[model samples]
Target: MPHGKPGQAGSFTLGPASGDVNTAYRYRLTSGSFDSGWSAYKPGATATIAPVPPTSGTMVLFAEAKDNYAAGAANSVEFVVKEGDGPVARWNFAETSGAALDTSTTDQSLRDNAALAGGAVRTDRGRRGEVTVTRATETTPAVKSTDSGLKLNGTTDYAVTSGPVIDTRASYTVAAWVRMDVPTRNATVFGQKGVNRSPFYLGYEHTSKKWSFREVNTDAAVGTPFSYQRVESKRPAVPMVWTHLAGVFDAVNNTISLYVNGELQGTTPFTTAWAATGPLQIGRVHWSSVYSDYFPGVIDEAAVWQEALTDTQVAEESELIDAHAVPSVELVTAWTPAGAQGTTLRDTVSGYGSDLALSSGASLADDELVLNGTTGAGTTAGPVVDDSGSFTVTTQAVVDAAKILSKPDGYKAQILGQRTATGSSWSLWFEKTGTRQEPELDENGDRIVDENGNPRTTPVPVGRWHFGRLTADGTGASVESMEEALMDTETRLTGVYNARHRTIQLYLTSDQQASDGIAYTAQVGTGELAVGKGYLGSWANFLPGRLSDIRLWAGALSDSKQVSDVVGT
Candidate 1:
């Protein structure tokens, strides 16, 4: 037996009608004691069972055939019925023959009038135009993905109806998965639009390349193309990509909102009283006006709800449409200073064995790891060799003059740096030289020449916290700093190096100061990654501040969104 929802009419077919051409068939159904007597015998044909009342459990249907040739055997099949509040009409286009099946009990099946124009061809769950029509006809385009969708020809293609299939007085949601075949022109994706009445329209405008929503109402001013309230997405929609577009009209909040890929794009006030009195049309505003704005794209999984959907519901439906829209990034490492002394700060993403060792003078205090500036106070780990050439390192540090982190460099050194100047290096410190305070720079903005002709650097102030980040890309190395004199104690710093984009970004959380797009040459080094103290003060010097929440990413966080996602915390 075929599957059906409760309160829906059941349909059954027994094909390969064999033997005598004059054969006849009889059908009956039974559920417990309730039974329908065998129907009068007739020519071999499929049966359209009457709509059964909402039911549960199982119903048995039997069929037997007979004719002037001979008597045929009997066969039976059982059907399981389910009860629920489902869609008014759901056309998955899974039918192989006949009109598109209405999967809902309400039986709002789309009226298929293929004979009036070019017929539609069905393949798998998708339907498309088999021939070009002189008159307007509905055309479903082929979708490249798994789920089937409908395609429109921008002009002279649309689905029209004599009456509205959906009615809404207060709240409603209309959503669909759409992909634009032509992005240079404006077009309507779906609506019940006529010259004067429409509940809503979800479409795109070529001028701004943005998804827009419009709900018909006479109260709105007449100067606009749409008399109803309108809201366009803040972010423009990209062409040729599958996007889930939805519009929610909420009378309770007097707001009409637009959403793309489940993210709320924009909301506008919609206080005018409204009702859709015209017929529904898909792909175009109407069949009579096919020359007007018509959608030129593939549309699928369209749904209309009488109630405004929540964000979570919209998100869930978007997932059912496509899961590849937002890609996931892999994290490399995460470290916190809240653990006990000598506890290992493990790498969260991969290679946990490369954990940092919490050692000497590095004591856990006030929920942070304090480095004594003298002796060995910090964490150390073996080398982290990355071939990707892209990396993001973030740390929250509380320092006072001493080195914050070092690779293998020795004494008289700044906070973060490699042994040689040619290697990727970074530093954050107060004093450049405690004993012999160096001048900051010469008149040419170059380091002052020392007695030996080597450039002499200046020393920053001491006794306060400072944030600094330095990154190297293909062009060169760039540095950003938040000086102690300008910021309060402690600060969060994020450094990102993206070789592909040839950009570096630094975020100073203390003041929310972001130094973005600092042109820098890219450099890929083979040195292992390390934290805190380098060579002894007799060598390089240990960090003299606290460090907390150290994290590393393998890929370049090239965008502001990626940067905010990481540094926001």
Candidate 2:
């Protein structure tokens, strides 16, 4: 039989009859001839038939009784058809050192065409790597078990090619299995673009930490600021871990939807006219002006579809990614990345204390260290809290500077940075010293006033305070805040390491209640967790603000109703 399940259908074909003039062929079963009659045989035309299997057991069919000629010997045949059509474009990323190939039926292949020569970064930690690709004894899905994946170094690594033009204004879906190194910045997963007013893009916003789907329409006129239509997930993506992401745009309904790990995140109405006419970029946006949106991390089984895949299909795709993920539950160390300026980075939980002094430029202002970005500040002991398995770390602070914390390795392991440099993480920031507003200017450079005869201009926000908590655990990582800052009372940011769930949860509140929060899978590394100042060599990472009441917990805090008691909410 062809290649189908017990109750599935299969198609069979018989060769064109030959051997004599006016010859014909008829097919039959062992019991009797089939009800469908056969006719004259042509030189090239073959008879095709589709039949559903009656039961699980095998069945045989016979062919070749010729017409106007002597009967020929019967030929037996079998047919089996499998269920489901595969992805339109699927990249297994099995190639370790060369171009990324498309394993889909479209033959749309992509080579390692990095725009910059030294841009592509190669690592051995792929899912199906030199060793991890081994198959399990149990019956696992083939797509999930196939080994190997690609990792993109945030700075420049990405895979690009042209030809697969999927219409964003029509029904379509895009999906991928992603493992982010640091989930910040406007990181693009995959997009096609060429400066055509508006294009389709799926990316994560570093400042908001939310997954977004955007369709641009530059032709929009005034009073329609909604020209840049988008549907953002209600929550942010967990940093430094693997997650399944899928976005579907249905033009008929003028709605867009996003899914994380097979769950429907949210759906919103969005109507816009846009087009994309550039090379299909895997890790970055195609527009040259916005190269900063390049994806930073590993992507596997990236795919695109001409039709919106049903929720069921997205669930199956998510399962494929989960099969390869191995959960970790070990706690390496936990500490708040904030302390007195010019002092040692003290550990609150594991007590893996470090006497490593900070750079002289670091100064204490109201108990928190103020870094000038150029000054070096961190623990002297390298890899102070190194753990091979898993870990959870949490800290809370109010920062005015944008690049609040970074590691020494050229800002490679940044802990937290402002979403927008001028603003704080949780609070609205206004520069300590700046004019709030000026007279509004017209196109002719003349001052314009409103109907009330006053300067018709909006107040420019110059500064704002920023505050929030940062968490990193085995399941994932995140920087979170309670939407706004609590001016009178301090907000508590809590991170819990649930090894059993192989995930980390983040909570933010001022009333000591761990209410609704975001959770993500964690990223594993041996690098030491630093605080206050990062990018030691460059002098570009310094808190320049205060850090207070930093503490840590040993493991996943018990799920007690009084969560605030453990880590003040």
The candidate scoring highest on TM-score is: 2
Model 1 scores a TM of 0.38
- Listed per model in order, the count of residue pairs whose N, CA or C atoms clash below 3 Å is 20, 36
Q: Model 1 over residues 214-300: C-alpha lDDT tens digits?
A: 776652333544456778876566544356678888777888888776667778887774665565566665323333567776665
Tens-place lDDT per residue, model 2, 1-569, is 33653324466776644553435567664455666765666644566655544333446667775545566556887543343334556666766566666656643343223232226654444432222244445676223222456778877778775454466567778898676766557888878755532366777877777778776654333344435567776655655545568888877677888877666777877777465655667888754345558788777668887666655566556545223343211122343444443455554443234343555655555555444545534434333211111223344545442332222212222223222122111111111223245578999999998889887764432222222222121111333333433322343444454432344444554232225333444332223334454332232334444444444322244443324433444
Identify the runs in model 2 with alpha carbons over 4 angstroms from their true place: 1-85, 106-118, 127-147, 218-226, 287-290, 321-569
Candidate number with greatest lDDT: 1
TM-score of every model?
A: 0.38, 0.41
lDDT (0-100) at residue 485 of candidate 2?
Answer: 38
